[model samples]
Target: MMKKPGSWRQIVWLLIFTLLWGTTPAVGGLFSSLSTEKERELGEEFFLELNNNYPICTDPFVSSYINRLGHKLEAQLPPHPFKYRFYVLDDPSMNAFAVPGGYVFMNSGFIRLMDKEGELAGVLAHEISHIYARHMARMLDESKPVSIATLVGSLAAVLLGGPAAAALLVGSQAAGQAAMLKYSRDHEQEADDLGFKWLQKAGYDPRDMILAFKKLNKQRWYAGGQPPIYLSTHPHTDTRLVELANRLNMHADVLPKDHDNQEFQYFALKVDSLSGSPYQLLRRMTQAAIHEPNNPAYLYGKALALAKMDHPDEAMGALEQGLKLDPGNYFIRREMAIQYFERNRYQQALSLFQRLAQTQPHDETVLYYLGRIYQEQRQFADALSAMERVQSLNPAFVEVYQNLGTLYGEEGQLGLAHYYLGLHSLTSRALPTALFHFRKALVNLPLNDPHYARVKDQIARLEKMKVKVN
Candidate 1:
């Protein structure tokens, strides 16, 4: 009656969903069906899961900067009322994908190759173009049954190979889907044209777009022994490069003048600071940069590289030094906050988080962490308030509901407790979380515990259901 969880039908739908949501676009064309709300929601959930699980790379600065860049590009895109969000995955793969709805994933490897803001803007703009054109929806239309097929194949791949091996095959299968969705040669050309146009709109170098592609092409070839899966998803490197060149030739005189990105120096420095290497090695890199004091970017990079391998006390000192030189450096503050959070100094972390919240009041991440700190301190009221803000900002945050349910259960508010607990049950996979909160309620309530009896029964039933599913 419950569909027996992970039944053949569920497996079939999962595969269909994965394929429908997994592949990249063909030439840059738009489809009408993506305009629908249900498809958009499904696409959003799929992408959010993909990103949460298999991020692109590991540097915080790159992830944050790309998300900023994405928002800027999204603001400049053609108006169609739908939720659009951009994220940089913590991966080193040199590729980008636009999922159903407007979710975009850019890899860190893409960010590392970027020298100018325009190149980064170009990449984001191209992905945005796919969303505006509804290219993913069109691809889904053509590959309808492929979703079911790909999903089944993916499940088989997973069952046969385990999750890790399944990931490898999934990437390849996704590339195959991308090849099939290839926008018309013309759509591809238009995307290049429009993407560069937006890069100029965003006040970045148009040529960087061309250069980024060339660098990717070279990287592909240089990776002789290992063929990068990224190349598999991308259009022909030579073709893309030529198209960019031809566009630049046509608009050579009219193109915006090359712009210098002061932020790029900060971005690069922030990334280098987080790399894993010996302190001596980092000190040497910093020493070389210190010798060339005229180059502020190099100086910043050296400071970051040093801080990465230095002790926490030393790292804080180095961060302060860099901040002294560049007083308005937001990245330094963010990085410092990260260091504090990592070191388990929640009091200091709370202070930094509060500061960031003032600037980014609606940031779910800031609220989530702020709430976490309060929870750690046993300030349940404050924790609930903070988490409530996050839930309001992004209602899809299932964990926030779980946390709120837990807080309510602890406070003996059974009505509020069960409401949030039921909300958590609808969205979360961790049975223990719900079970723990419900059990807390059971213990605290009246000995008669009418609500306790109901919850106890529900918990038992759910546990039995889980056992069957397993």
Candidate 2:
């Protein structure tokens, strides 16, 4: 039997948050002694490790929307040294976390739970506050010296989750755990206070912060004693709720009542469609479409769920219906093109993708699909051009390097092929494999070849990285 969305989220949350509880002590002062530059360097290292281990949501629309929202909240803050980057992890847990420096992550399930844009903005603002106030560094400054091996082992256990987390906390002292819990609670309170202030400054109602907490609090009841990790780390107390209400009352005359935001609604639907069981999502979206017969968003969501369930014909029909309601909907068009591609309707897919490329020039997903279509049709040059654009727009897209390598290899450019394959391996964190490819590229290319120098430099960098890891 399929797990209900609520149950699924609870289980996933338990696994992910267990890491936070188990590893908090080790993380406390891990980066406190480092300079700002060193802190950022460590953050980059953490980000890379996560990308290698976890499934990060690379959907262009989802990532861009979340980043834009994060930056809007960030704009209301005073100048800070670190550059902020927002990411949506592919996990279905109801939690968000901020690491040292300015890296913030939100789970896909958590985004789906939000009803208003301000609720999400409030969450992001709270995370930003943790980074802005240097809470991690401060906490670490007061912590005792812990072995580096123990710290690494604890973090790995958390990331591994499930049975590993249980084993990690098997012998943890109760006093140490209690102290870490108190420390976490204190940080949560400070984040909430500062986040509320920033949310108001950014022209979002401060009450939305209260609403966000209320929603999480309600989830705690649904989960009984095993509440989601967000609640565990940031306990929702009566006093906290009362304080937030009082703060909002002070600005009641100036604050506007929360209303539905179309962007939030659309993105929430998208996240839900992407994360939930296909059959269940299709059932839910089907009912939603029937109730609001003219709503394109519902139809679009239904189309995606249908596609997920391997009902291509039904998915295409739904997209066509949605297009009739909103012909200019970029999302609907993109879905239609994807469906066409899946059905081997090459010309139809190519036509739609080309049109979309003209309108959404910087849309990485659009360009990526366009490249795929071109590749399938044996238009290697066009495919290479499209992929190059995608690479320039988002280097974090690991697939572009893979595709580029394949295309170059097909075109009899062995040196270039090896070089790109090396890059693909590097981005995927297969350092030794990447070094091998880089070496092969250098061996194949003539000494005077322009790329020979580049490949040599890459080889040197990878070797240094391997040394540092050792």
Candidate 3:
């Protein structure tokens, strides 16, 4: 039958999906709404699961660029309860999707396919409109409540390739499946209309929205898996293309001026270079470099690809060349600093990260690196402070937890050390280990301690779960 859940990651997603699906009930009147708070809660949980199970891009420079662009368009809309979030998935499928409560995901493959920032802006705008309209919530409320099981099962089936899901998929009605949940033509039209208007207001050409769909219709570069995931989930692209064309013509008088996006080209190249098979990526970046030997973006791509292939020295040379071309490019500098750290050039790495921290005072990635550098230098206090800041800024950053655990243990802070180890265990899905560490932390932490409550919560959560701890 279907291949049994292909990887541990996929199996974890299946469990998460099933567990989360049970929490939100469709109990109100038909088409009645989910409270903004409930939708936000669900979206947050969903995003966290995606982070744990999927290949999400965590590159600070790229993450910052997408959020800035997504929020720029979001500002044109009237007030809503959402603090909109955008994420880039390290997937090769030419797709993007919006979930409830202002969460939108962009595929790296889709971003790489875009010709310019306008196209990406258009795509983000459309997804934003869908969230603003609460299309998914509405769909949930309108579906036959019983049919929702099929929907969950089908989506979970994508993650769990086991016989149970395979059998479930075989009998599931086409209408009850997740694919059927793709926005209908009317929903697509509404998003298109609102998206284009917002795109124009955001100083991007509305016509690029149409161009985005056209490109999707022609996209063939992907290695031919089941068709692009975008067209499946965001169906009716071919029909929407014609409609978007006429709609653009009708509003030609008020189109916004074409703004040049200096950041997009570099961002796109980074995604392409970082999110591909390393060997093939190196070849593509190298060929591009041959044609435009002085292009820093291409140089950056080559350097990154070379690093991925474990050619550290070659990577360093490419980064040096990139720095000479554009000495002020912070991303290249960031990479060079990372290279230095990996090669144990700790002094050079520390100097570079210190400069980065000054510019990006709250960047967790920069702070994380500083913490690591400090740890290597045996500056325990400094390492703890830097990593503590990172944990405060983004608790989901798994790398910091283990380091914090070690640093705290080294400094003889038994309570905090075990507490952080508990968190690290949680991230790794080691439930019994997490429970063990949390218990140890609680026993050692005094009630007056700042981390006491947090430790209690972690213990309570693990104890509540039906898990066996050896």
Candidate 4:
């Protein structure tokens, strides 16, 4: 059986993970004094901490799909001050949350829970509403001052499901906690109202919001046989459901439009393959493939599960079958290239990636693969070029930083090697280590070097952030 959500082992893991990453001073709550700039900075800091501590799903297909969906919803919203970002957290809990700024995260579990694209849209729309309406800021405005340590401790306790932790944190601030809960309920209602409007405006069915809520409500009943964290925070009630139903009735004339079901199926299967155990996922995909013999997605997912289980030959066979079914499928071709690269078929992998690159010029994953193939082939110049393109396209691609550092070190460019290594460390959220590398790069670099100022600035910024985090 799958491990229950909020299991003790999971809680312990989360507690340890949060502690290791340290804590950021909670920003938007009773701390209404924070300015817009400060809120953005705090959000960035929290993002870094999460990147360091949490298992962020970096699968290229998954990331690209969510971002595309999120941006579509974002386009329908009015202008906002903060730049929005969407991320998938590798957690198997049906939950989603928005930070003080425009940082939104959806758990892989939640993504799997969604039955349709519009259901996913409804979740994103609701979270986006939270950010746009400045709900956190207003909540902070209404509450009394709470220390950062106390707030983090409370959060940790919540994650661990420790009643003692809750009692310890809330005993003195019982009235404040009550008020905050009430305000949070209000925030949920407002988000639902605004989210319904945005989803409809974005050309998605408003009825899907009710679907999403019902799914969560059902999950809450069996979520470790306790209330889910989402319900604890969002608080689903009959009143909320009635409100959603009434809105849908009012907009009953707006007929729901069709979406690309094939694309949705592929994305959903990918999520399932990534989240479930390899053997279980393989069995499920095999059954799916048997039922839908012509569907390439099930074959592709089976191939992925096979690969995860270290059955490369079986994986390749599944991929070949998938390719035969849908020769022009991008995902199948991409998986074939990856499998080829793993088996050291560099030329074949290179040809496939290069072909894909023509259409996806800005895809960092493709560029990274191209760079890796070149590096393995000992084509130093080509490797440098490919990795540089990746850097320019997405600075957050941490693998490129390590590869560049290795490439420069091989060429005996110590300063550039240390510089890129510093960047890799920075992206990995090892601030002190990053600062050390940046300082070393600066020491080796010439005073008149063009890169000198940039290295110095990085070192200074890391130092400041280190102080704040510690």
Q: Highest TM-score, which number?
A: 4
Candidate 1 lDDT over 1-470, as tens digits, reads: 00012333443444445455542211122332343653465454454334333423324335445566777777776677566666554444566666656677665556667777777777778877776776655665665344332422332333222223334344445435434554555656666777777777777667887777777777766777443444554556678787788878887777777766878757644543443333544665567656765444554455455455556776676667767777766656666776687689988989998898898776666777778788889998888888778766554344566788777767667765765775465344344565565565566567675565766764674464442221
Candidates 1 and 4, the one with greater TM-score: 4
Model 1 alpha-carbon drift over 4 Å, by segment: 1-38, 48-53, 56-64, 144-184, 225-228, 249-254, 257-260, 268-288, 294-310, 346-372, 378-470
Q: By lDDT, who's the top model here? A: 3
For each candidate, the alpha-carbon lDDT, in order, equals 0.59, 0.70, 0.73, 0.71
lDDT for residue 296 in candidate 2, whole number 0-100: 90
RMSD of 2: 6.2
- TM-scores for all candidates: the values are 0.67, 0.77, 0.77, 0.80
> What are the runs in model 4 whose C-alpha is more than 4 Å off?
1-32, 144-183, 362-364, 378-420, 438-470
- Which parts of model 3 are misplaced by more than 4 Å? 1-33, 75-77, 144-168, 171-180, 220-227, 247-260, 359-364, 378-381, 384-427, 432-470
Model 2 residue 37 lDDT score: 64
Ten residues in sequence with the least summed lDDT for candidate 1: 23-32
Q: Which stretches of candidate 2 lie over 4 Å from their true place?
A: 1-32, 145-164, 170-186, 201-203, 253-260, 375-423, 437-470
Estimate, for each residue in 1-470, the C-alpha lDDT of model 2 and write its tens digit.
Answer: 11122233443343244344432111323333556764565456556555655667766556666877888888888888987888877666677777666888888777877888999998899989988887755654455544222333333334333333455445543223324422266677788788988888888988777787788777767777576666555664556888778877787888866654876877777677676777777788878877888889888888878887888898999889999999898888987987898799989998998899899888877888888888887888888888888777655455578899887887778888899998887766677777888888898888998989889877775665442322
- Select the stronger candidate by TM-score from 1 and 3: 3
The weakest ten consecutive residues by lDDT in model 4 span: 20-29
For 290-346, candidate 3 gives per-residue lDDT tens digits of 888888877777887888788999999988899899999877888788889878999
